[model samples]
Target: MFEKILIANRGEIACRIIRTAKQLGIATVAVYSDADANSQHVKQADEAIYIGESPASQSYLQMDRIIQAALDTGAQAIHPGYGFLSENDQFALACEKNNIVFIGPPVAAILAMGLKATSKALMEKAGVPLTPGYHGTNQDADFLKQQADGIGYPVLIKASAGGGGKGMRLVERGADFLGALSSCKNEAKSSFGNDEVLVERYVMNPRHIEVQVFGDSHGNYVHLFERDCSVQRRHQKVLEEAPAPQMAEAKLEVMRQAAIDAARAVNYVGAGTVEFIVEQDGTSYFMEMNTRLQVEHPVTEMITGQDLVEWQLRVAFGEPLPKLQHELHIHGHAIEARVYAEEPEKGYLPAIGKISYLHYPEQNQNVRVDSGIVDGDEITTYYDPMIAKLIVWGKNREAALVQMHHALGHFHVEGLGNNIAFLDRIIRCDSFKHARLDTNLIQREDEFLFKNIQKANAQLIISAAFTALLSLFKQNITANNPVWQAESLWRLNISNSYPIKFKLDDENILVNFSPVEHGFIAEYQGQNYQVSGTLIDQNSIHIEIDGKKDKLAFSQNETALTLFSNAQNFKFAYIRPDFNTDDSDSNDHNLKAPMPGVITKVLVSANDHVKKDDVLLTLEAMKIEYSIRAPQDGIIAAAYFQVGDQVKAGDELVEFQVLAEDVA
Candidate 1:
């Protein structure tokens, strides 16, 4: 085995590679950009090197810098841990030219599968099942539209280069084809430097199942079963699992063989995944082959008892296949949830900030957390927002799901919005539980999934009031008695019998609280109860109400508080005070950036007339593009940003002049 390998990546995947390298007694070097100087992956490596600035193009994607770093650190091999330069054929060839092993597929394989159109043609020639579509080299828009017409309605236009739903569009009709095609081509050109596209027949109900394949330098290969990645949002996977639920052995065999054939077609070596789009009838089609390790490889590892990264290392050292295909067996059901720092209610925009408080649930034999962040770390907009991959294993799918739900509830993170609540809702949904899933599951059930439920409970109001009271008490006691002990006695009294109201969804709850012995007495609806607790920390309060045997863990902030108990989390929020009845409303209106991102395009100029829902500008962040729209019919008074300007959340990008009659 090589003595040292340079991990040419950052974040979770870098940490993942480092852990395996350490297990193999191989020294690992990490490369980081300025934005990732304090990242956890950097701290875990044996040695670290600064590559370049924050922008990926100047740093992570800088082939010369990464190659030099590897050479300087005396690394014999370089592991491109997915994303960034993982699939860059030139980078792989550079390693060969430098006499350093590239810990992935050969350069020829990467070039073969780098372009979607080329890959499709290759798969077709190899007799692999393919979706019916156009793979012609012609770039004429009219010809593409004609091809889409021949393929029927609801076709997909995809960029020949890159993935992650970029430069992809779904056109339901012929009339909208040209416009959507132009937009998709523009996005593809901007994202991948390639405007070429291919038209494919869109599967109505597609289940994303990918098989993990490994190859050695001796021309030996084996498959590690498959993972079902059907749960997705905006064409990106959210949750994944191994040994797809409700899948039959026959269909599994078909997919397994197809995956092997796809890999062999490219003479693939090292770790790669062959992804397929399976229909509801059990028929599957080859989607594309990922030339490197995948983000959801952990799910496959959990089920097969294989360390994929270790395999990558062994193969890079020119070792033969570790095991025969017949020796691999599916051990148990495993599930993985990708916890991201994004708000589900806010269109899943990337959230960035300091993680003031972070806590991972206690791990057992069945549960595991692969994370690349710490409590004090900041989640910035310069990189992917995935915080961690929480995975769980069990004897059966149901048991694994139960454990996963519990683990998600127990996991706590603060200082930025996240999708834990949304994930919980997804796992608990009836359709998901029944395994009635497809690529469009999130979009079809988005309304039910992203609804905020914390605003409905009366306990939320009580929790907020208790939190405010605790904060006030702490301030007063500290100001008056600097040396006050934790056991110091304190009492508070209520002034008026005002009702505290809370609202979630459309439901309202009213609660009243008054002073009592040690704590407080509270009444909601027709029930009366006694509540007592001490502030355990800045965010949580240990409370016992009405002689409950179990102590409740309550966390409160300005907007919401979650009551945690029995490995379940119930969210609550303070009711917005009614100020409209007394205070006059301000009439200032402006368009703001929803998240920190670079302004990609300005759709409207100053003094331009626009209707409600007209495109105002586009912001690109975390590799995703979002188009901001006008809230109402108005004239653009001013525009604050041009293309390529970086802006933060709530930063005004445009101002509108509302008519006198339109102003409320």
Candidate 2:
């Protein structure tokens, strides 16, 4: 084993690699950009080095900086932790040239498997079943459209070098093929520095299952069963499980063998995943292969009792396979939910803000949290918004589902948009419980998953009132205010009514309360209730409302107070008596950026006419592209920012002059 190794990545995966390296008595060095200077990975590693600025192009993807950092730190090996440079064949070859061990597949294997077009052709030659589509090197738009026409409608245009759901578009009609192809190519070029693409027949009602395959320098190989990653949103996985439920032993064995064969075809070494798109009838077709560790590898680790990172290290050190195929066995069922800082209701738009408060379920043998963030960390737009992964294990699939539901209920966040409630709903929904999963599960279960936002009920209202009261009381006592005492002496043994106001998602709420012996009596909307609670800690309270007692969790920030109850979070802003509302932009005839991002394309010029829903511009943030469209038939009065300009949320992008209703 190498004595010291540098993790050429940041965030959770980099921190994850550091953990395993330490257990093996190997020193770990961490490289960070400006954004991650205080990140958990940097704090955990034995040594840290600053590579460059915050953006990946300026830092993480700077191969020379990373390589030099590893050499300066005296690291004998470099672990590219699954993103940025993990699957780059050139990066792997660079490591080989530097004589530093790259803890991944060889350069030849990476080149052969890195591009989807190349891999599919190689798989076809190796006798691995492949999905019907075009995998040629032709980049002509008209040629690709003809191929899409040949394959029929509903074809998927995927970036040859894309992964993690980037640079992929599904066209349902021949007329939409050319436009979708252009968008896909642009995204591919922006994401992978490659405009090359492949068109494939999009499999309907498909379940994504991928097998874990490993190899060693000695030419030994083994299969680590499979993981089902069918529950997805926007073509990206949201939930994953190991020892895929509902798969027959015979079919699983066949898939496992096919995975090993795919590995041997490339002479693959280290950890890799062979993905397949399984139809409803159980026929599996090769989709693509990831040449590095997967984000959801924890589920496989939980089920198989294997440390895949350690395996990567061992194999990179030229060790033989840890266990033969026959020796490996799946233990219990495991599931993993990716907890991201995004809003499920708002098209899963990535959120960027400071994580004012963060709380997670307690971790133990059965429940695990792999994260690189602590309280007070910021979720910026520079990197992926995944906060942490919640992985749980149980004796069976049913039990694991139950555990996952419970764990999600306990997860909480504040100061940004999050999908904790959405994840909890997914685990509790009937379809997921019954394992009726597919790539379209999120869309299929839209009604249940994206239920209408609920207003504050009596329980939540009283909880908020009492929580605010107690919080103020604590502050008074802490500051040694003589007027406030624990005995209610401030009221002179007489109960006096007080008014508490709050703003709940733009709606104002007012509650009147009178101090009582044990708690408080409150009135709201002509209903009176008994409300009392004591602060359990900074973030929790034990309350009794109208004779019903419960303990709830909450987080209070400078601007808002959020209560976590019923598996959902309710945010309340303190509405002062003199608070004023801001409606300055209500009638403004301008389009604003919904989120902070860099402008990639300005499709409309000042004074240009555009129809409603016309593509006006495009913005890229967090590796995803969003098209800004015209809201009505209008003439563009002004286009504020040009391509490559950085804009914050609510920044005016274009001003428009709407046409009169009677205008011809």
Candidate 3:
């Protein structure tokens, strides 16, 4: 066992590794970038070292700095949790050269599985079932198009060295192949510095099931069962569950054995995952192997009751497998939802801002939250936008779904956009509840998942009004004053009516509140309701409206007030009647950056004519590329930013002069 280990990663994974290290009586060292100087992982580690600037290229990906940090801290082993240098073969080799243990698979295993093309070829040789497509190494665009044409339409062009949904595109027709191929290769070059790509048949309605396989240097290997990661958006996983619902025991054993064979073929050591795309008929095809701990590994942990990080440490220390295949069994069903700080309604664009208020569900044996952020921490464009992961376990899949829905409902985030409500909808939706899942589940269930089932009705209006008034009253109360003085507003015999206005999305709401004896009468939409509210805590309010009681979680900032009820979040902006709110000068003809990012491509110049839907520029943020398009046929009046320019949300990227006849 290592006396001390250094985690060459940040955020929740790094923090997660440290907790297990501490439990094992091993001191842990944390490496941080400028952005994560005061992050939760930094505060939790036994020792901390500054690595470099905020950008991952200058920090986490700087293998030398991370290795040096491990050496300086006297760390016997370095754990590269998940991203960054986790699967980089050179990093593993470098650790071996420095006599420091890399708590992961051998460099040989990493090299074998590093590229999708090579890994698929190797898997085929190992007798693992593979998808029917081209995995050969011809990088020519015409050659790739021909392969795609032969494979049929709707082929997936994936970056050979990609993971995390980057550098991948789906072309539905031969005409669109070249363009999609170009974008895919550009992203691959930008993200992995490898432009090589492979064409695969895009499996429709496929379920992404991956087996968790672990091996020790002693030639011992075991599979920890599987996780279904089919619920996805933008080819990225949103929800994952263990023991994959509806899989037969016989079929599972075959996949598990295949996974073990994959590990054995590479002489793999430490933790790795073999992913497969499962069809509706139960047939499965080999995807790629991830040679590190996955983001959703907690789901497996909950079901197996084993600390995978601890296993990694033991394996790296040359210990034998902790448990044989027969000894390990699944205890229950577990599911994990990735809570991201992004707007689901706005094409899931990453949101950046300080977390003014953050509340997670109370964790117990049934619910767990893994996060590396606290209140006042900012979500920046420099890193992934995942705020936390909420994992829940239950005796069965249905029970787990129920737990996850409730857990997601209890989550509240303010000061930026988030996907808490979206996640809840996913768990509660009929398709997910019935176990009808696929990689395109999100798209198929889009209407229900993004539905506005609940709105600001009279009950909600009264609750919001009473809570707002009580919050103000509590703020005005002081230690030197009697509480009755603060309560005098209700004591007055006269009914003083206060008119409050709020904006929910695009709808405007008006409510009138009049003081009464025990509560206030709220008039909304020409209906009156008696309302009273008590502050349970800073983030919660217990309210009664018209003899019915409800408890709501709420958070307020300078601009918006948010309320969470019935598994949905309603964010309302206060409409001050006295303020002049005219947007006559605001130009709809101008194209603006939807979020903060760095401009990577400027496809249009000033005075250039462009059709509607033409790509004007491309911005890269949080490792995702977003194309800014012309909203209408117009002539570009000005292109404000060039390639490589940094932009903030709503910064004008291009000004357009639209045809006057088309304006109306």
lDDT of each: 0.83, 0.89, 0.89
Task: Write model 2 residue lDDT over 528-584, tens digit each, in one string.
Answer: 997765788999988888889899999997777899986689999997656557787
List residue ranges in candidate 2 displaced over 4 A.
Answer: 452-454, 475-484, 487-489, 492-495, 577-587, 662-664
- Model 1 over residues 32-81: C-alpha lDDT tens digits? 99999988889999999999999899899999999999999999999999
Error of 1 at 488 (Å): 6.1
Clashing pairs in 3: none
Residues 12-66 of candidate 3: C-alpha lDDT, one tens digit per residue: 9998999999999999999999999999999999999999999999999999998
Q: Summing lDDT over every window of 10 consecutive residues in candidate 1, give the lowest-scoring window.
A: 475-484
How many clashing pairs per prediction, in order? 3, 0, 0
The lDDT of model 1 is: 0.83
All candidates: CA RMSD (Å): 4.2, 2.6, 2.5
Worst 10 residues of 3 by lDDT: 475-484
Clashes of 1: 3
Cα lDDT, model 3, residue 656: 90
